[model samples]
Target: MNDTPITLSRADSSPPRSRSATWLSLGIGALVTLVALYLIVRSVNFELTLLAIRSANLWLVLAALGVQLAAMLFVIRRWQILLRPYPTRYNELTQIYFSAHLLNTILPAKMGTLARILLAAEMENLNVGFVFGSIAIEKVLDSLVMLLLLAVIAPFVPMPEWLRETVTASVLLVLLLLLLLVSVARFRSALLNAVTRFETRLFGAQSTRLALLVRGVIESLMNLTRRRELASVLFWTVCAILAGGLVNQLLFAALDISVPWSATWFVMVVLQIGTRVPALPANLGVFHYVVILALSVYSVNENTALAYAILLHLVVFVLPALIGALCALPISARLFALLTNRTQPTTE
Candidate 1:
């Protein structure tokens, strides 16, 4: 019997997939750099030097980072809360730090999703299929909640035609996803049996594995099936969303610019969705490109917009990354774990 911990097959041939993702991501990055440069050069205030760091809204930016951090803390707490019924010991903040942004920088696709799943699986020595199914459920819930917040804040802003269309389509997509999950939950047994039947007809041992995977997904969904549990998670989620909105608002506030609260929500939603489209490391170029595009359409001045976009990203990106590294290495030799987690791209 293998008593010591055994690492799973790390020879994930997923590197081939990552190689393709990298080239595509790099292209976006290059385009982003071009766009940012264009905006900076053409801006009406190109002659204006940046405000000294001392004179700028240092307190407000720090406060914004604090709010963002707290919002993430709440999300971690919410995840821990949701898993209360399960046997799991996730550190509220540490997991979120590593799972959301840190792994986001390092992983490909939705490796942050996989990171949390892998961490949970390792810590509890649980089934990968079941743990990962929880991740899928979590992702769906996250998308739906963000869209719901976006919808609620929509009425407060004068949205441009482009954003309005995007939001409308996204809302429908979110609805479709929610309905699909509900249908699966309703007909889980039939779905499972059908999948098992199909698998058995095809690959024998592989079908057995597929059936197990199906069961795990279904079981994870079952964990959230209770109205009480769902409601509890939603309550905390609502708080986090509000906190996130504040962070977005403060991002603009730090620029000495005022956008409608609705605009803040819009930017946050846009940035979250935009960056996921396979950008370069740290979203290097694309971050400025998307934010500038979004703000320009909103009639924000180009110079102020570029300044706001880059500065806000620095706060949100670099600060969290540094903190994530520190937190991961605070006590344990997880410094290597952080390096392992940070250097390697995520496997969604």
Candidate 2:
């Protein structure tokens, strides 16, 4: 009998279907990238785009990079808050965060998230499900902050009809998720009892480990929802979003493009929502397309907008990857080993 806990068992279970699905997703993403690149290439003057990028103010670009780092710090702080009572060391956590950032950049489908959850769990000797739950709460807080920012800016900015509808849909979807999580957290004990009963009745005592894993996840969520933790996480989330907006503004300045702060905020919001779609690693063509779309409303030329998008991707994705490599190469190696089933995670 393999007495490994359910978390490790599930993490190591990579059946043929899963491999096929990952390849299929990558193929689809590549096709999307080619199509988007085609459209962009047809619309923009390549020379002009190169010239715009070349002419960008180097000093402002540096400033934007600095702000981007600050934004990442805010994100790390929010995650720290979610990881209450974990006793995670600041330096170690920072490395893990950026290492995950690097994985997120190169891997398709945000696999970096899983890496972070696993690494954090191992580092803190914590339950894998609990770490997963904390990350879930982090995502929920981000969605709420983005929606709030969109609402505050939409009234002042001239947004496209499609974007407005997307925002509306997003608001409803996030609210629904938030409500569901809250309900689960509120009645976690009862939920656990129900799960155990169902599993026992269906599969006998052998299946109870799954119930225990679910209980860990639910308890983590409940811990995160306590008033003090929620408030601190919310505050850091707002700071992170605002810091991201500032990076956008700085990038705009770098390009010497004069646009309202509202437009910058709107573009940030669009990028956030757009990148959530499964795409080539680091969002590739999708990032440029949405940036161009958002800037079009403000009459920014396609070439210049592409320049901005390229620079933005560098600061947002490439720089972080470099930092992560420098700081967390060993951790990343372990993450890949775990994913490949080269090594199993130790049972908690």
lDDT of 1 by residue, 1-348 (tens): 113322221122112235576567567666765665565566546444254233458788889889878877777766665544555565633554454466666544545555555555445544445666566666677777767666777676566676667767777877886787677668988988898999888977442556655665666666676788788778878888889778868767766776655677777777766665555557765687678777775678666776777677777777887776665544234333532443342233
lDDT scores in order: 0.63, 0.79
What is the lDDT for 231 in model 1? 84
Q: 148-197, model 2: which lDDT tens digit per residue?
A: 88888877878788887888888898999789787985687788899899
Candidate 1, after superposition: displacement of residue 16 in Å? 8.4
The stretch of ten residues in a row with the least summed lDDT in candidate 2 is: 1-10
Clashes of 2: 0
